[model samples]
Target: MNESIKKVAVIGTGVIGNGWIARFLSQGYEVTAFDPAAGAEERTRLAVNHAWPSLEERGLAANASKDRLFFKDDLAEAVSGADYIQENVPEREELKKSVLHTIDQHARMDALIGSSTSGIKPSILQSDMIHPERFFVAHPFNPVYLLPLVEVVGGEQTNKKALEQAGRFFSSIDMKPLTIHKEIDGHVADRLMEALWREALHLVNDGIATTEEVDKAIIYGAGLRWAQMGPFLTFHLAGGEQGMRHMLEQFGPALKLPWTKLKAPELTEELKERVISGCEEYAGDQSVSDLEAKRNEFLVKLLALVEEYWPEESQAKANI
Candidate 1:
């Protein structure tokens, strides 16, 4: 096995996979990718090209170039001798496990495999792998090149050393590596997001607020605080000198109040139309691609501001 990651193989070049490829290439890693879909190479290349300007603004690595990307029709050829591997297959457990098993068979023994699965447990995906210890979940948010947060969760059979190395590798790529202490269905961020989404659905189902209204509520309020401080810390400050303890005491009774729906509302046709129509009204005539471009532009600016504000942490993580 190679001693360090010089080349990376990206398996399943969908949105997430292509994002991973762009990120690796921006960091100057030779990236070989494979996807069986028709026009996979074209789509992946276009995705990378679309993402390149943002990456260039962020500053590319010395060896970073569009020329470093290679597309392979064969999965085995893509993985063989690769120093690092990133798997971004579908969410299905059986399919992901099957692809991972093949990737493990072909990749170098010491090369770590990071899956882009957001919800699936690493243990389930690695169950069929011949070398399960080398595999772990390295879930990143959408627009993976700009977003630096990556949740690194290891499985029961996953080697602790491999997790550490994976953290180092992700950090080296200018990402925030969150090593989850335990295995859970949704991991960390997604679980928190799921709770909020369920309540939002209930609100929309009851006609209490339109989807756009709910989004505006977040966009103009708690969302801003959440960008810099977590919910607990934000509430802690709300306690005013007494900290989280006082905040909990003051609002603890609200926990039992019928203020939220933990269970998601039914996706009835009416509610779907209301939500879709409301979103469309809010979006005007914009397509999904148009929204994505706007989002990436805003994200790039925010990423730079945050990095500048917390230079010590972000830069130190990048130096890993």
Candidate 2:
């Protein structure tokens, strides 16, 4: 465990898993990736190629290169010598449990295994693992190569030392790991996001707004501030020097008003079609790959800006 991680294993080659492999390789780790899905290797190669430009702009490590990635058909062979393992299998409870248990049998006992699960609790996924203490959640946002935030949540059987080790390793790869003190299904970011998603779906289902309109509401408003400071801190500034207390006092009464729908509307065929068509309209003539490249480039610049300005607030608070 004291040794530096030279090799990492990625358990799936889907979007999340592909991103992880690219991120790891960009940070100079030799990565061995395995997926049971047909054409997974080809998809992984294309995904890595598509994401490499952003990583290069962001700056890669001394040894970082796409050539460092290896594909393995056998799961055990993929993880055999890896110092760390990231599981990006589909988010099904029993499926994750089974996959994790199987991985546990092959991977080095000391290697920390993390799930890129967006919502599933780690305790359940690690239930059948031989060394549950080394298994935890390392949930990263999409386009993992560009995003710095990664949620690190440990299960009931997870060891604190193992979590610390994993967090340190993730940090070394330039990720900001937020270690959740208590386990939650969606962790922190996703829970807030799910609420906003449900509200947006309600808006669309009620014919109040199109998907593009909902997106504009975010891209032009709070999303800008959110890149630097979180909602709580941003609202504290809205208090006009009285801080969050005044902000809460002024806006607290509005909480009783039914301004939003908490429950999501059912995804009926009409709703699905509306959403799908709206997305198509938003895309216009751009293919999925085209849109993804644009998004990644914007995110790379945005994250760089955040990294530059984000520390100012912290320094100012410290001066106070």
Model 1 is weakest, by summed lDDT over 10 consecutive residues, at: 311-320
Candidate 1, position 31, lDDT: 92
For model 1 the local lDDT of residue 76 reads 97
Off by over 4 Å in 2: 312-320
Per-residue lDDT tens digits for candidate 2, residues 1-320, read 53478899999889999999999999999999999999999999999999999999999999998999999989999998888999999988888888888889999878889999999988888888888998899999988988888999999999899889988898899898999888887999999999999999999999899999999999899988888888999999899889999999999999999998867889999999999999999999999999999998898888878878885655756311
TM-score of each model, in listed order: 0.94, 0.96
The number of clashing residue pairs in model 1 is 0
Alpha carbon lDDT at 138, candidate 1:
95
Candidate 1 — which residues are off by over 4 angstroms?
Answer: 1-3, 310-320
What TM-score does candidate 2 reach?
A: 0.96
